[model samples]
Target chain A: MTATLTAPPARGDERLARQSAFSRLAGRPEIGALVGAVVIFILFFVVAPPFREAPSIATVLYQSSLYGIPAVGVALLMIGGEFDLSAGVAVISSSLVASMTAYQLSVNVWVGVLVSLVVALAIGLLNGYLLVRTKLPSFLVTLATFFMLTGLNLALTKLISGGVATKDISDIDGFASAQAIFAQSFDVGGVSLRITLLWWIVFVAIATWVLLKTHLGNWIFAVGGADASARAVGVPVKKVKIGLFMTVSFLCWFTGMHILFSFNTVQSGQGPGNEFLYIIAAVVGGCLLTGGYGSAVGAAIGAFIFGMTEQGIVLAGWEADWFKFFLGAMLLGATLLNVYVRRRAETRK
Target chain B: MSLVQLTGVGKNYGNITALSGIDLEVGESEVTCVLGDNGAGKSTLIKIIAGLHQHSSGTYEVNGREVHFNSPREALDEGIATVYQDLAVVPLMPVWRNFFLGQEKRKGLGMDSAFMRKTAKQELLDMGIDLRDVEQPIGTLSGGERQCVAISRAVYFGAKVLILDEPTAALGVKQSGVVLRYILQARERGLGVIFITHNPHHAFPVGDRFLLLKRGRSLGYYRKDEISRDELTALMAGGAELEELSHELDRGGGGVAAAAAKMLEQESKELGITPGSTP
Candidate 1:
């Protein structure tokens, strides 16, 4: 009726137009986060002279890596349409497990690290299994897990070691090697960089490849976008969700090992509310809270913005108390920018 | 031989009879339309054929061989594909991604984006849908174009029998017409196409054979030559029972009921059915 009731053209539909290369780049999911990052960086550059130094930039990167590593997992989970509240405490839980196991049994720290990996993954599996079997929202399930991990981290640590923190394991066998792999720093051009900085870049690159160049990546988006449609098309919705939950666990374990080896001690109460930081980074980087439209690079950039805000204030001679307020402001600003850019991209052409 | 044939098919849910005594035959290059209202066992029939459910009684033959499908995967393995309305493609993904969604071409450990992109564009072009860019998200396409993508994907995957469950059930006038065109396109490719819809106007134009169903039983099955469009409408609208309702309303004296009765009366007249006159 709309096409004059004539026969459809055997070629070229008029409703679609080939967008220009520059316009397509502007339409990418990370564009908003990139813009936000640049704005924050330039803001700090103008206000703080020390922020321009190479060493100071290295410090900012090191801080961002800490948040970025977990943000990777959080970004993937959010894209798959779930989030983990237990992630912050879960990292501490891993470190506690490793430190206590090595101190109590007098085994090598590597043995403790391996055991922590298993425990971390189990926690993730539980979160996934409960979600799939009960069909409850991931919010409630992970919130409950967050509280439970917090309690277990404290009570179990107290019960085993009689203190809120575990004994230092720097003197344990394999401590030096484990520290080298997980917490050691390398110097480049008179600037020292943590190994996690390298890991963060590598992980982000791998995630980007999987998302754009692999079938599993497509399934992840499909499952998050419309799981019922994914199921109808024969995609394994349950396995993908469960696997995502486990992936968060695996990354948390890596993050936990860094803490244990670097500090040589485990503080059970240290990481209570850090989950929000990871989530904030993901959201600021342009991950939709509802899932299905996000990128890991956006999340990494979000973490960088976070690191810059927290450290930039200190360098600018501002009170550290203003960090939370600034972070909240950036998150709101970035999310609005993302929504605006997304609509423009879709409406263009 | 028919690509799909169901003889005396029936489905019973414990004591409830969801569908019964249903017979359908779809052959190569033919469009078979299943017409029904809500709760008319249309979905049950689609399910049985799609392998989501099995018939409690009767034989389901594929190429003259009796077969029962335990799941959609099994049905798909036998070259039977069902495209559900509103659940065909992932919206956020690009058109090419949705086209090769579950069936991506793998290059060692990764999807061959180069090969798949070229093939998806070529495949859509072959079906006469020249999209501007395969990189754009599939959700940007109109409702009708999305359905066409699903239909073309089924054809490309070697689906010998394509079962569409209300492809135009949620579309607008022009969009529905667009989908109707693609229905003919699938039939032209020599696939047995089963089109299900509640609108007779949508079905009668392209349907080679019409199966009018009500409640859980078949009202009648007729080839295009055996049933005229008016007869098909009357049959789909409850044939003799509709004539009784028209008279009952006509006998309700006056007021709002009289106005509604007048509309129903004129509708029956347009279709050449004299209300209260059909025996």
Candidate 2:
């Protein structure tokens, strides 16, 4: 009953078109972002001589990775049809927990790191749990989490440290080793490249692979694109969504680790507005704001766009304030391009 | 034995009693058409059989074993696959991806993309559907093609019984014809098909048995030998209403209406319903 077809396979159907290589390329969600990246790369390369140097490339890449690393998780979350506003302050929350737990107990920094990991994952779990239980828009749920984490980050840091930031933990046991993994920079051809660059590339590679080549990746797209359809086909929507939220938290913890190791101190106010930055990077790279249509590589490209504009403006000898205006315009342009690409793909046949 | 049989199956959403007192049977190589207008409990029945909801009463048997499905997965495990009108696809995904969505074939750690893509293209071809490219987003396929893709997916997955809910309700005349062909194909392969639709014109040609549901209760059930196409059409459209409509047309209508009224008179006689009788 299963293997038989009504007819033998045909060689081709003239009514249906064979898509051209160009049209196929145009169908990628990241094509617009790729074009945008190229334009910016050329713009900066020609205008800012300093930006063309290898050392400056490392600096730009380092800055990109800071946003790029967190954007990786946020991209996955967005692709699953949700966004996390708490992602920004959650990084600070992680660092605060790790620092305060260690400072108060006088334990090895690794212990605090471990404690922070648990708490971070809990935040993710709670976000996912609340979403499925209440059936509320993820915006409302993650927004509430954002405010709560913000207040807690400030209050807890001020309460324990009696200041706006944590005490320097560089001298603590396990500090050197932790810093080596999270903050070490290696020189390449006399140019120091931040270790985060390596980590960011690796994270994006892994995320891209999962999204394109795994059953879980397919489920993530399914749950986000059309959840009822996914459920009808037996894709577990709640479990997948919750898992996506937790992925975001795990990255928040990782980002927090990098911040702490690189600076040896945690500021209560450091992470307040960075959540929007990660999202912006994702959107700039070609992730749809609505979910189910973006990619990690796109978000990484978006972060790279951000880094280029930030550094390029100064190197181009332009006033720094224009950076915001330029970025806002780029976001608008890239999104419009994505919309055009999607519409074209849908009508191609 | 019937692959799927329902005796007095029903469902209630709290106290509304969405459906009740329904009977159906589907055997190998048979097409059982469940015909009804909107709000005829057709969707509720599908939900029950597709494992979206449990019937509040009566017995549902698959392969001679009584079963209550808690989810679509359970029903699928029993070799019952459902192709919904519009809900069977995640639009943005490529056709190959949607073809193997929840049940993707894998080679080692990742999806076997080459194999899955080739199989998807071949399966559609086998079903007599010509696709331009399997990599194009399934959303780009016409509505009729999408339904065909979904049907082929069910067949490939080894569905013993395939339930198609309003598969052609949204299609044009030519497009509907395309789907009807696939129904016959599934039947030829010896899979039981439960096809739900309001249009008896579409149902009569391929259906081996017809179950008429009105307002959640069975009007009657008959094999193909027991009813003619005109009788089925008249009954599915609510015979009394069509009879009254024919009478009104007879009073002031033209040649077309007169011919239709004459045809209705014979169909009415065939169904043991006297023409011009008051409801």
* Model 2 C-alpha lDDT per residue in residues A1-349, reported as the tens digit of each score: 1122345546664545677999777777777878888899999999999999988888899999988998999999898989999999999899889988888899999999999999999999999999999999999999999999988888888888999999999999999999999899898888899899999999999999999999989999888888888877778899999999999999989999999999989998888778988988888777777777888998999999889889999989999999889878987887788788667766655
- Report lDDT per candidate: 0.88, 0.88
Model 2 segments beyond 4 Å from truth?
A1-24, B242-279
User: Which candidate leads the pack in TM-score?
Assistant: 1
Q: How accurate is candidate 1 locally (lDDT)?
A: 0.88
Chain B vs. true chain B: TM-score per candidate: 0.94, 0.88
- In model 1 chain A, the worst 10-residue window by lDDT is A1-10
In model 1, where do residues sit more than 4 Å from their true spots? A1-21, B241-254, B269-279
The A-chain TM-scores of all the candidates are 0.94, 0.94
lDDT of 1 by residue, A1-349 (tens): 1223334435555655655898777777887888888988999999999999998899899999999999999989988888988889899999999899889999988889999999999999999999999999999999999999999999999999999999988899999999999999999998999999999999899888888899989998888888888889889899999999998888888899999988999888888888999998888888877777789999999999888888899999999989988878877887787678657645545
- RMSD in angstroms, all models? 2.7, 3.9
Q: After superposition, how far is residue A301 of candidate 2 from its true place, in Å?
A: 0.9
